[model samples]
Target: MKAFTTLRTTAAPLIDGGKLMANVDTDMIIPKQFLKTTERVGLSEGLFHELKTLADGSPNPDFVLNKPAYKSAGVLIAGDNFGCGSSREHAPWALLDQGITCVIAPSFADIFYNNCGNNGILALTLPQEACDVLAGQAGGGNSVFEIDLERQLVIGPDGAEHHFDYDEGRKEKLLKGLDNIGLSLQQDSAISSFEAQRKLATPWLEKA
Candidate 1:
């Protein structure tokens, strides 16, 4: 997991005009076909495959992610109920591969939100109006949004600050680049001590 403190980059909008696209499920983020691999690196090829591809198998030029200006976007201004279905961790993996480190939305599915934090991606919940404003700015082209996780602020292109709330424990883990495994390792001494005590108490079990 990468430490996430601050990110200053362009934002991509998953909005249509003033309305944000709702109920963007994990399958929509990365379709079933892309779930074959356990490795996270190459999943970007399947990120939003259905929406970004045409019937003829060509890239949809109209898609916000496919557009020239947003090709390198690092933040996503998404919709309400984003990441709404399935408990696939690959959704955030694909997003990370596509260079999006943070996602802003009005709401998110519980599992998906947890997965984002576990995988080092920031899933922010802001008011619907605030999301709409950021989406509008992102859709306007050549806009840069700065996300300061330490300060819990999202600075829009026009310099307006939008505050967001996050779980303190999750925030600390993200800031320190600690995943579940990493967090577990932090209790190494205690774990080792317990193992040693168990081994001494159950010598017959070890022999068996």
Candidate 2:
């Protein structure tokens, strides 16, 4: 898990009266045809690209994301275990490219959460009540929100705030944007020291 920290990003206003779309159905919001065109890059253009408008440049007014308030959103108050049902790192990549710095949810799939952190995106897990409050605020125009992971607080549109605590370890990885490989490399000095000590202590075991 990565370190968590307070982050502020523009939130995507969710419409349709708090409708919840979880698991694979979530990808329908994006689509696979666009997924194959690029690899973890250039995905932002494709993200919400189809759902946002028609080939004729007409807005799909019915789509939640296409709503006037959500068109330029950079964050999402998502359903539980979002990014579940698959291990596609592209999901977070697309979100990141679109300028979304974080996601607030009641829960998240383990791999997706990790992938988000690895790519410098924060994924905050809050209680359902807290999420509802955020979702409610999201329906407004350009609803900007902030999540302070260290303090476990969510700051809303009216400036009212709520708190939700998370594990200590997960917090650190996110703050630093360290993936597993990055974390391991951070231990390079310690690993080298250990190897030097082992060579002296077990000389007979070397190359034997």
Candidate 3:
């Protein structure tokens, strides 16, 4: 996982679901057909496949991600309940591969929200009105958004700051770039000591 301190980049808005445009599930983020592999490197090609691809397998001109302005967007401004449905880690992997390090939404599914933190993506929750404001700015295609993870603030294109709250532990992990494995490694000395003691107490079991 990469450390996430601050980011200043373009945002891609995915707010066209319908009504409240909520529940943009994991399957929608990366379709089932693209879930065949466990590797994360090439998942970007499959990110939002159904929505970004045309019936003829060409890139959909209408899709926000396919648009030239948002093609390299590093932030994603989404609708409510983003990352719902099945708890697939691949969703965040796909987003990371696509160069999106931050996602701003009104709300998010619990599992997906944690997955984002684990994978170094900032899954930010803000008021629905705030999300709408950011989305409007993102739609302009030229506006830049700044996310300060340390400050817990999202500075909009017009220089307005939207404050957000986040879990302290998760926030710290993201800032330190500590994934589960990295966290485990932090206890390496203690683990080694425990293993050495166990070997002494159960030499016969170790041989078996």
Clashes of each: 0, 10, 0
Candidate 3: where are CA atoms >4 Å away? 17-20
Give me the candidate number with maximum TM-score. Answer: 1
**Model 2: which ten-residue window has the lowest total lDDT?**
20-29
The collision pairs in model 3 are none
lDDT of each: 0.93, 0.70, 0.91
Q: Give model 2 RMSD, 1 decimal.
A: 3.8
How accurate locally is residue 46 in candidate 1, as Cα lDDT from 0 to 100? 98
For model 3, how does the per-residue alpha-carbon lDDT over 18-83 read when each residue is reduced to its tens digit? 323678999999988888999989999999998899999999998888999998999998888899
Better of 2 and 3 by TM-score: 3
Which ranking of candidates, highest lDDT first? 1, 3, 2
Name the candidate that leads on lDDT: 1
Ranking by TM-score: 1, 3, 2
TM-score of 3: 0.95
Residue runs of model 1 more than 4 Å from their true location after superposition: none
Better of 2 and 3 by lDDT: 3
Alpha-carbon deviation at 153 in model 3, angstroms: 0.6
Instruction: Please write out the lDDT profile of model 2 over residues 1-208, one tens digit for every residue.
Output: 3244666656774434455444423364355666675466688766666666787988777766656666566677776667775666777878777767777777887887777777777777777777777777876656678788767778887799877766666667666767778878899999999999999999988979
Residue 118 alpha-carbon offset, candidate 3, angstroms: 1.2
